[model samples]
Target: MSVGGGGNGEILVRVENLKKWFPVAAAGLSFAAKREWVQAVDDVSFEIAKGETLGLVGESGCGKTTVGRTVARLYEPTAGKVVFDGQSIYELPAEEMRQVRRKIQMIFQDPYASLNPRMTVGDIVGEPIDINRLATGEARKNRIFELLETVGLNREHASRFPHEFSGGQRQRIGLARSLAADPSFIICDEPISALDVSIQAQVVNMLQDLQEKMGLTYLFIAHDLAMVKHISNRVAVMYLGKIVEVADGYELYAHPVHPYTTALLSAIPIPDPGVEEERRRIILEGDVPSPINPPSGCHFRTRCRLAQPVCSEKEPELVDRGAGQKVACWVT
Candidate 1:
């Protein structure tokens, strides 16, 4: 695998105008038919400085996972740049890309489905270390044991298969695998979404502790606003394959700018029934438009209650407001 020099300064990962569009074929005769596409991630951009956690929040099917995958180079982008530790991954040779894998890893959304049912937990955790030639024999086994313990699982559990464990344990095993390579960055793709509600906080807290210990940078993708707020240093709100707002986590939560963002924040359930009942809910109108044929200008305009004529005529650029806050809307 090819290996480029480490990136400049503090930024560990940078994505520039990233786009991943899946092609859609013509239904019938294609002698002269034009190709169609599903814009999974359209012109999204962001950066993760070393040791920082950036939360990505959005409704289901809003391309949040696609952005994470595309940024990690799991999916070959249709257009855009992904620079890791100063190297442009898409521009690397196959072998070079393989080497880069050690520095970047991902924790999948479904804990049960993510782990290989046929493999023992020890083997699953040790696979990355083996692939990277980081350890072997007694050393590899020892490393696996250490990893299992690190993720809050007992060393004895390593010999068991994935099916023998519960949802949270499976996720811990998956996390152990990601850490096998001692990656500097991880894309957590809704890592707690499938676990029992009670188990979610344990995983999140474990991830936080691991991040602090390893000095890891993360792109945390999820729809759980409350969890995101607790874990993220900064947050970006995505809608219809586009980022509508990006700001400090607390700032964004306290003062959402875009109409879509406002609507989303409003839907988060407050714990106290009195407070929830007192707050006004902003219910958005209309369904999310098909990615294959999104609205002409701002994709969210179709459902935005405050959308104006200018929103349909031209796409609003993501402009900075202050203190690292940015919003893509005409009226905020």
Candidate 2:
């Protein structure tokens, strides 16, 4: 769903009816015990145009990471089709998929856990180039240095271990590693969430700069609304396991239709104290329901103020309002 605008007329990624479920055995030892499934991603659909950044935002455990992983084919989806550059990625054979992965890469949330403690930054960044056989010898070393420099790191930092670098610098190294694959589409899974607030802006600015320079498409997953608004051309709000609303960054922030969206935007603190003091905050009553057994119909109905009886009986489809805002809600 390319909401708010159709974008550059060239779609790079299209995910339709995507569903990923993980089976878990019941606690009982009996063979007759029923198995349950964790519906990580349920019928989620969206689109990303070439050179566009789509921000996916929600509270923690809303399945944002799972969606990104499934789109990248890191997780085997239980159902649905992921079409990238007009090709159905899930249908590809092993060798073809390996080749396709070169164009699709992910920057994970944790800078500390994602990198190897023992490996030097040089080895980590050059691993992708080695796997794809993109370069070797002096050429490879030069390429590594170039990548390091591209992400604000110098050639000297390449020889140091991950432990020697700060959180922001470590993230830069990870970004350089992803660039090593020469990917056109990158999934930034909360890449800045672990860093300090000051460092977050630097990373986001660097991402925007890289996107403009490289013509990159990103599925930026994060919980920071202000940062998302700054970097994303369009934004999609995810709930329990589904997308509830999508719109242009400005439109979504300015006029949110869904109750859930309104509540989310209300939580972002304003810079001006005058406006902040006058604004009304929407404090949701209950905690987020479990993904294992989300509420029937609308998953957010339980916490929604505008929810009606219909919201409990029928799940709303994401329908487009005027000016390209798409929302799934019974009452706006």
Candidate 3:
């Protein structure tokens, strides 16, 4: 796979102080009881430059998907601003937002569940065209076929049902659908996670090819560090709901500052037996703390081996650590 460089340009998607908290209510007793908010995403801020792919990597339930969904306007953020192309997306009215939706699209995690079973592959891929009124009849059908071919699928397969295809094929179909409207920004929420291990490289390569050809920007959210390193220009390591570190992909892998980032990179399996044996695995004890009632200051403090008293007392703001990298750990 060829790694492409990002061009200098204005920010395409800017998420400032983003927060998405889901309410969790008690099952039993009174219906009028107050609900507790699950802090899915808390005070997260980042910017994606035009034509840049910023991979958001973290463990499951770290609110990566929530951040992506909130940016895509699928879920209304509890607070903060989502600015797209110099305009505040959250502030847009329904009519205007409909147009904004065309430029921003999402490829969900589950390809099988994301596609409509009742609809054929043609309708599934052409739904965006119909909604945006970009094309109709023969023109729309031709566009759908074009998209299918773009994502490595044959035009003939467009008429088949999604259930008839394999997992990888379904994901390619999903990609074709997302590209139907020619979106500039795509939120790839673990798009390859559900596919076979062998097919993961193919999907990643396809995305990389499409990004270069179409000048597409991606908010690539996934837990696969290896894949992220391969495809992303830069990567943001997220812990709890906040981004702990952000740096160039190679730089972050070579010189990870945050304890959490260090531990995550250490876990990536090495191919060479001797090298793997020599590498030290940094294991953090215990599960991630509940988002509803997270630790007082640094969320990772509970599992952090280098945690000091000050870590629990104050939250660490993501600060520049020289060389265009930012880290949010007290020790770092």
Candidate 4:
């Protein structure tokens, strides 16, 4: 998922057989270090409508974040197509790709590291506008002010450095910078993972409001099932770089089919103490397989409780099970 979220207007982003692999040198210090490829993402595909929040959820190292970055063309894909607004993003020439930056943007996971401490908030927010030559003089200043205000900050904040703000405030500054270009699509890459629990709700609510006001598209990537359910129109569950299930949020929560999806949904805490205590917990055994040499057939078979002999012989395809729900497990 792109972490890009809502216009309900049209299909704005399509990822077809997207793959990203990082070549790793051999572990030994010998002269001949055999090359190995870490399959961060393997043939992941999805589509985001103009106005929708497609949540990509999974445990750490499942390539959920990589999927978002690849969709935005931040990391050059090893193979496959990332189509945005009817254009092939990776096929575009250098000049054209640079121009496309104006239409798409990303809010990174770490606000403290993403913002430059030396530059004032104004400089940080104005960088995009300056790079794209979107504004100049007081016009630029006014634009920066407007962006800051849009994110719940003030014009006075323009003079301060990143270190002057708290974690949540820094994140707000990051959000302001993402909107500096007035992008049509934004990838919110775990934007709330670093903030306080209380602050997370504030930021999420702000994002929802901004979507309504700007008609922006978002791919929201996170492991927080509750938050994803609240913000996303659809949700995808990924395991070992492959999506195992996807569907509308309500349908997914109500009737998850894949074993991995069921385990994930089972882990979400119920609101009521009595219900939470009574609900069954599906504890998955074993660790996630190494992506460099993932298990044959279904990558999730090793950890799935419902694994069968057929699971080791063929990887199930993600097919529609009904009601817009798709699952990759044969038993489901």
Candidate 2 local lDDT, 1-332, one digit each (tens): 43433565588999998999989877789998889888888999888899999999999888999999999999999999999998999999999999999999999889999999999999999999999999999999999999999999999988999999999999999999999989999999999999998999899999999999999999999999888888998999999999999989899988999999999999889899999989999999989998888899999999998889999999998999977789999888
- Compared with the true structure, model 4 gives a TM-score of 0.96
Model 1: how far residue 170 lies from native, Å = 0.4
RMSD of 4: 2.2
Note the residue pairs that clash in candidate 3.
none
Write the candidate numbers in order of decreasing lDDT. 2, 3, 4, 1
lDDT for each residue of candidate 3 in 1-332, tens digit (9 for 90 to 100): 01112346678888889999999885568988778889999999888889899999999999999999999989999999988998899999999999999999999899889999989999999999999999998999899999999999989998799999988999999999999998999999999999888998899989999999999999999999988888888899889898998888999999999999999999888889999989999987999998988999999999999999999999998888777688998886
Give the per-residue lDDT of model 4 (tens digit) for 1-332.
Answer: 33222334588888888999999887889887788899999988888888788898999999999999888888999999988999999999989998897888999889899999899999999999999999999999999999999999999999999999998999999999999998989999999999999999889999999999998889999999889988989898899999988888888888888999999899888789999878999988878889999998899999888889999999888887766678888676
Q: Which is the winner by lDDT between candidate 1 and candidate 3?
A: 3
Q: On residues 1-332, what C-alpha lDDT tens digit does candidate 1 reach at each position?
A: 01111233388888888999999896689679888999989998888888888899999878999999888788999999989999999999989999998889999999878988999999999999988999999999999999999999988998899999989989999999999999999999999999988899899999999999989988999999889988988888899899888888888888888888889999899899899879999987767888998898898988887888988999888888777788999867
Tell me the number of clashing residue pairs for each predicted model: 6, 2, 0, 12
Q: In model 4, which range of ten residues has the least summed lDDT?
A: 1-10
How many clashes in candidate 4? 12
Cα-based RMSD of candidate 2: 1.3
For candidate 1, the 10 contiguous residues with the lowest summed lDDT are 1-10
- Winner by TM-score: 2
Superposed by TM-score, candidate 1 places the C-alpha of residue 186 at a distance from the truth, in angstroms, of 0.6
